[model samples]
Target: MYKEPIFLKPVFKDRIWGGTKLREEFGYDIPTETTGECWGISAHSHGPSEVINGPLKGKTLDQVWDKHRELFADQEGEDFPLLVKILDAKTDLSVQVHPDDSYAREVEGEAFGKTECWYVINCEPGAELVYGHHANSKLQFEQMVAENRWDELLRKVSIKPGDFVYVPNGTIHAIGAGTMILETQQSSDVTYRVYDYDRRDDAGNPRELHIEKSIEVAMIPHVDADFEPVLSGNEDLRMKKLVRENYFTVYHWNLAGSVSKIENPAYLLVSVLDGEGELKVEGETSSSFKKGDHFILPSTIKNFAMNGNARFIVSHPTI
Candidate 1:
């Protein structure tokens, strides 16, 4: 059983639509000027995070999941259920859609789908995203695509800092340019691109578009769900419940001084988004943390206290 917090090293990915905001904001040693994503907490094959501290140090999260079941409260699963990422969109991302769990299992042989939520960290003035589509039916979606009527078929929404957007699977969406967001989602990498702005890669080849797959999975008649965050806390800490869905529950924690509580979930995934703090697993060990730090509080450490002024995006997988 693990008795300490497991800090993970993020894996960065360079994308065509990426930019230097990751370095400018988080102080990450980005691999390229176009570094787009920091896979902060992940166990997917595409980008598994490695434990940077504790006894599990140097072990990839995938290895720990496969070898040490006790660390995750003995949760039985073939793979980790959640992924956390920070995306910097210097240019618009491809308009895309993802399949549901049933579709993913049957068609892609994957264990999870891609229902995701984005916490808008920061964005330039007037930044907008493709939130959903206007197509009333699959046939109409196809017809619009065939006619290249993007203006009439896509629905765009303006966003700003601290805004939360829940994106369910089958929602046709895209991240617009000059936006940065912290994303929490089911651990899946399946994306079906519907549009790419006719942009070509370095090889001078236009990126692939999965028109059939996108139409097969996109929700007919997009409907945005109403998510009003519930707020509660004391003088020292304020908690905003972002969303509680089938796959995971996410929250934003703002700390002014200190707070103590019992760790109740199977495991807690935490990303320090602002300020600095120290976490003490009561009677065990304590560590200092600051912005851009990511760690998992395993089930083994039940009671803990955190002190300092900071903000964190905390989440846990749902059974």
Candidate 2:
């Protein structure tokens, strides 16, 4: 069967500050919704169907979850797999951490934890994002929490285009502006916010903090900080690869009016980043293409090709 990219609606969490319909505003002004993914397509049940097109077509993310459930857990029942979203983080988000699988199942029953990464779309001057932190122990993190010195212990880094940040479960981090990103993560929204720039809600109320939980889950000596994308040759096919020992390996393929083929990775998600293109599957199967759309390559698609001047991000877990 043919599959295509689906654009879902983004349910916004209105803050004291937030753009009006980020998908319509920022996505039109800048690039797609590959930024912070707050009001972005949560992609699944908890996410919005912000954008759409292609074979996987009308299938809601929940439907896909039933099929790809094995990837998330072994039991007949399990937490949904990774949630993918395009984030247009117009401002700084909270510094938080997600519990690991063990902690999640134990503490937050019937829930799975989220470990994620941000594939930068566009970043502005003076932008910074959460990388890691200074504390080396959970007890120490708790102490910092007691004194509210979490920011002092965090490892903040300058943000720019073409950057990749992988945040595993238990790592404290946040997405800072100005940034747009493609986020992929375990399908759970159990985030423990440690800090949020003293910003209030529309009613001027401070957002409550999950201080104790954050202190318990924050990882020490966080090793997956300071991430960089791996650039491939340009000219005919310019590809940039971002790999983390996580649930996904995201890469951008910028190509001229030439054909290219990628083999091996069982299934494929082609999100057109620029221009138009056609994908040729193992059989005579082919699909139309456009920017900001997504399509899934048949798990049976042994081979495929690009037949136009285009650019897209191919995402999949690194087995």
Candidate 3:
């Protein structure tokens, strides 16, 4: 009977490399200039998003997932399987890597790992990011780290807006300065930092580096994820399948006008990137959204239609 979209209030996080672009670009009432992240659609304990509409108003996404499982089609998982975030990197983030599901559960005692994909929202000219490493073996990787041969060991790639990059578990990566992106990933927050550019904290203490764990999990001779983004639809509404993997399936929805009715078999995590739109659920005038808005379409509401000009990043956990 829950027919409306579940809008969630974003929970912002402060970081050393953060900036105010999140507010400037998205019109968010950010808490600080150093706000680096907006956890848009999340259920993780660290920063769960709260429901902003309907009967679930004021409840955190985790509560709705736990108490009202049918909203997500009774998805099988102890924790919500995915998280959606928007990041503003005013400066380079720490070069880091994340563990896979097995390592996360066995060592961190967590339900999931952090395999994520990024859709570049905007970036500065000549923007480049650490994507992987040049090391061909663990011995070489350890030696490079030991010798501080950063320039020789790290692999960098140029990026631009509208580009999609997939960072699988164990992939060493970093988000460079003056860049903004939307990230979708497993609902985990365990990051093993390898390098921090010799940066110090506000207290004048050097940031800690998880060298050992990073070395243990780092993929020797980094492998790139190979996949093609399939584009579909027409001038009115162009739907691009950005990714379809074991964990989740993501799409970039570009709407210039009205779109025909669509059915949702499972719940959907949606983030409006730009422009404005109205969503009609089962022909019910339920919700309207704009740029920077994030919400969920519960499984109970099977059909919906869209009207207006806007772009959205949409995803659903692969069940």
Candidate 4:
């Protein structure tokens, strides 16, 4: 049976639009000044996380998933289904779209497609994101792209800390500059860039744009889904159900002292965003956790209790 929480070491990624907030705010030993993303609890091929604690120390999450299926409650999938990341956007990201599962399987040869949600960790005042497009039809979308009418076609929304947005596949979107967010998504990296705002790579060439593929996959008229968070808790701990969809379930948990609960899901992914805490598994073991710590509570741990004042973003795959 699982006793100790499996803590994972994050893998960092550098991006042209990245910044140093990951280092300054989260106290991470960032690799570069332009380090943009931290793959905190990921098992994706691009950046698999390494276990830093317990018996599984030094093994990658992907290795554990393949060898110790029971740790994940024997989830039926060839690859891990979920990926969690923290993004620090110093400049605007490329305007892009992603294909759904069917499209991704057929075209990209991937098992999952990205349907991501973002928790706004922090942002500058007047910060905005390119959430959707104004095009009413496929024809209009193509026309706008051809005519270079970005200002008229892109829909910008002002944002702040603590805001959350759900982005399903086929939705054209971009993270604007001066924003930091924690992103939870399916374990796929098939992005179809539609616009890059004339940005060039270090090689002095314009970034590639997938016009045909993007047009084939993008939604004709982007429609935002209404997701109302379910709030429930007691005097000690408060839980905010962020998104419960086909891909995954996410929540924000705030703990004041201590709370006890039975563990029933396949597994639990916990990321401490603020404060410190200690987790104890009944008749097993306990571990001290602090801000910026990320871990997994395996299904074998049937009951657990958390004590101390802390805030977290917790998630688990749906299938």
Off by over 4 Å in 1: none
Model 4 RMSD in angstroms = 1.0
Candidate 3 Cα misplacement greater than 4 A, ranges: none
Best by TM-score: 3
> What digit string (tens of lDDT, one per residue) describes model 2 on residues 1-319?
4332234434444443234334563343322333234433344455534334444446555665566543222224433355666666677788878998888889987366778877777777888988788877777767876787856787898977877677778787888866777777766778788888777775789987888787677777677656577887657778788764656677778878665666736555555656887766654656777666655554555566667887766776554
lDDT of 1 by residue, 1-319 (tens): 5678889999999999999988999999999999999999999999999999877889999999999878888888899999999999999999999999999999999998899999999999999999998988888989999999999999999999999999999999999999999999999999999999999999999999999988889888899976779998887988898999889999999999878774556789999999998888865688999999999988887878889999999999876
| Predictions in order: lDDT | 0.92, 0.64, 0.94, 0.92
The residue-by-residue lDDT of candidate 4 on 263-298, one tens digit each, is 546699998888998888884587999999999999
In candidate 4, which residue ranges exceed 4 Å CA deviation? 262-264
On a 0 to 1 TM-score scale, where does candidate 2 land against the true structure?
A: 0.80
What TM-score against the true fold does each predicted structure earn? 0.98, 0.80, 0.99, 0.98
Task: Kindly list the per-residue Cα lDDT of model 3 for residues 1-319, writing each as its tens digit.
Answer: 8999999999999999999999899999999999999999999999999998889999999999999999999887789999999999999999999999999999999899889999999999999889999999999999999999999999999999999998999999999999999999999999999999999999999999999999888888999998889999888889999988889899999999998687796999999999997999998755889999999999998899998999999999887
Cα displacement (angstroms), candidate 3, residue 193, comes to 0.5
CA lDDT, candidate 2, residue 89: 65
What count of clashes does model 3 give? 0
Cα lDDT over the full model 2: 0.64
Which pairs in model 4 have colliding backbones?
Answer: none
